[model samples]
Target: MGALDYLSNFCTVTTTRTKHKAMQTVEIKVRMDCDGCERRVRNAVTSLKGVKSVEVNRKQSRVVVSGYVDPNKVLKRVRSTGKVRAKFWPYVEQHLVYYPYAPGAYDRRAPSGYVRNVVQAFPDHSSNAPPQENFLSFFSDDNVHACSIM
Candidate 1:
């Protein structure tokens, strides 16, 4: 047999013998408020069987768990934390939603409204101004003082 034929035979044999496991990473929407809540949820999830890792983002109210795990089991474990509420977000097959926060999922109405106000007020200013600066400027005015100490 020639080298080409030998290589093809080897490839075919390897392909026949090898099997791939279907490991899935599931992203869950969690309602978390603080760092303590996040820690509680993370610990609860990481303790579950087949859970490789757990990541909790408090600001986003989301958790990402990866491994060969049952999505239902994972959700149950997360909910057991009692610090947050967890749910699976349905994903589209063609789009392949990998992360928890789908489009506009993390977008908040308050921040968007604030952005709209800023844009309306400063229509002439560059739209590219950093959001942190804009938020800070909103708080800097005397009329917006947060504390009035007696």
Candidate 2:
């Protein structure tokens, strides 16, 4: 019984560590006016521990970091590079958006296929189709208590 208990504890610890080190991809948007700006952002993020790869697109001002690091930590690291403060990439591919041209979801500076992701992320229960109503449900003539008028 003691051996079983020890195995269970070891398994729990392994699971917790695996969860914490899961690979994640974080996308950040920072204004890069020139080659130097792009280089700075890339180098800054690449130096972080556990970062597997960093891709920077100067035109779209996007930096995609793939690794096993906390997302908030990656964002903070990017901001420390002495460039324009970074923001999590708020845009999604235009093709993935339910309403690509939604008023606040469209950005002029986003990449050709991407749009700001301001549309609702979850379905609103209030907007769902109302429950089907039966016109005869209110009448009880079919039952034992038929109306006298009938």
Top candidate (lDDT): 2
Clashes of 1: 0
In order, how many clashes per candidate?
0, 0
Our tally of clashes for model 2 stands at: 0
Candidate 1 regions with alpha-carbon error over 4 angstroms: 1-21, 90-150
lDDT accuracy of residue 133 in candidate 2: 65
- After superposing candidate 2 on the true structure, give the runs of residues whose Cα lies further than 4 Å from its correct spot: 1-19, 120-150
Q: Note the residue pairs that clash in candidate 2.
A: none
- Give the Cα-based TM-score of candidate 1 against the true structure: 0.46
Residue-level lDDT of model 1, residues 17-113, one tens digit each, is 6354358888777877777878888888888877887777665566889887888888888888873346774223222223324333333422221
* Prediction 2 global C-alpha lDDT: 0.82
